[model samples]
Target: MDRLHARYPFLDAARAAVDEADVDLAALVRSGGPAVDRGVGRVESAIETGDVGEPRRVRAELLSYPVARVVVSLVDDPRLTDAYARAEARTAHERFVDDVEGSTPVSLPEGIDLGRLLAEFELAAAVDVGVSVGVDEDRCTVDVGPYLRLASGLEGEEWRLVARDLDGGRVPVEREELYVLLREAVRERVLAGLPLSVPEPVAETLEPEVERVARSLSDYELPRSVTAELTPAAFPPCVEALIERARSGEELPDRSAFSLVAFLAGAGADPETTAAVTGLDPEAVAYRHERLAGENGADYPSPSCAVMQAYGDCVPVEKRDERCERVDHPLNYYATAVEEVSRSEP
Candidate 1:
């Protein structure tokens, strides 16, 4: 596989490289090895940590992208789709940003350049390159249509057109904002034509990978209400799992740790309580608790079900309940579940 293809498996050139190699998915999955492992890892890591982990082997990395697409297709969940696309876009953004700024050493001299990336998204005509303008080194204009389309999902009052620095048919933006818009474009491009058709033979070959990812979609069960009562029995399954892991004092993955601490902090659990459950250094846990309070000025919300599931912080499918279906957010589930526990105790 070409090095560029391994770096960006979504590219047409990458696809062509795969085709030229005659590496069939069915055969590859059946045989199984580094490529398949990396492929499964890509989807799982994206959902869990929000990026396909660092590139390891060239062939494995390139092949893994296709494997990941196939698995995501077989799994066929919109949450996974959203998570996977976001992760891919986020990952691409990091690489592209480093390359554009000339900070990170280039692994491939001809990887996706800014000009081609903009042109690929058909935004080349719409975006005014800042340096090319020969005046301001930090500002550029994006056509209204592309700007609106790309920045639709962006939050904050600053993203609004009325608040924007508009010049004729274009909206002025800084270099950083330009990258943010490009990230959205990358997400949309990656999300085009997804949940591809997986033939029975190929599907059968990829059953294990499908089973693993599909199960991740179910972040376990438990109803909501009264998240601050300090009742372990009232916690949702996903939270319970995190607590279990945290109590071991072994550091959980970043997402899992955030879910645990955030959920506990929201539940009116004190720093001491968090330390006790997590069994980590009391000072460290207390410091995190203080930071959380300072950062949000209140309890940070426990990650939502879709987010939890995507992050793999949620438990297996078999643990999910009807309440999991009824409730959209972890806080909501805890509210009801904690109420039930409180009432039953009295």
Candidate 2:
């Protein structure tokens, strides 16, 4: 693989290059060599930091991106997927920024050039790269539609339409600002092909690496988010049981974790706060609640007790009380408990 493929493996050309090399990804996984090792490290580093650790041997580094994807899909955790995708995108944006600022048409040797990068995402027609910095200091003007598609989810007010310079139909952005939107585009591309169907041999072969990354995420400290102000005392017995285990750093089963998060969210806790309190992966939590959210902004209810019981998510009989017997679902138990708790106060 070339250095450019190693740097931006999400590009279509990178995939085509791998096809040209006739590399058997399944064979790479079974071999458990540099590509697999670096693949695991790439994800671990993403959760711990924000980028795949650093440059390594070109071929191994390029192959590791797909290996990491399979490992992530095998793990099948939205949190891990989001984490890995962000790390890849972050690394690409940084490398592309260097390419943008550090290269000229002739001096460039390795890595993707700016024109090709935009064209890969079909943004060539949308991004006007020609601009006089002496006058506008704007690096480029992105058509309003493409800019909004990529920048709408960005965190800052500056990304908002009202905060931008809009003329006719384009949004002018600085050089670094363009890099940020491209980062989002990269993230979207990486996510588009995730959760690939892994061959049985490859899945079994990569199991250890998958387990390691899973444990890393489970053990990783909360990065940052608003904590939900919650009353555990008012929680239903079953949810309280799960929350206690989560707070103690035990990784709950997927169904159990989803139930707890959905319940807390339905109770008015945002994803960040729920993740903060329950040790759920923030990205997973955000994606879950976002997917299940209504147009009016309400979260769907957690799985009912029967579904939880079938999934073996219900707490043992000892954890329940008379209220639990009376109520059919966890949320119902919570409402009763919260109402009673409020009444018992002064």
Compose the digit string of candidate 2's lDDT tens values, residues 1-346.
Answer: 6777777788887899888999888777877888888888888898888789987887988888888888888988765777788889998888778776764522324546667888999998998865532446446889999998888556434777889879989898887888898998998888886789888988887887888888887665312111235667877777877878888989787667767777777666878778887887889888767644442122134666777788787888987788877666666666667768879999
Badly placed stretches (over 4 Å) of model 2 are 103-111, 132-137, 221-346
RMSD of 2: 13.0
Q: What is the Å distance of residue 281 in model 2 from its true position?
A: 30
What is the per-residue lDDT of model 1 for residues 1-346, given as tens digits with 9 covering 90 to 100? 7676777677777788889999878898889999999988888888668898878688889999888888988888765876788889899888778877776657784666778778867889999878887858688889999998887655334776788878888899998889899988878877887988888998998897789887765542221223344877667788888877777666887657766776777677778888787676688667656545322213134568888889988789899777677777776677767667768885
What overall lDDT goes with each candidate model?
A: 0.76, 0.75
How many steric clashes does model 1 contain? 13
User: Whole-model lDDT, candidate 1?
Assistant: 0.76
Worst 10 residues of 2 by lDDT: 220-229
Superposed by TM-score, candidate 2 places the C-alpha of residue 9 at a distance from the truth, in angstroms, of 1.5
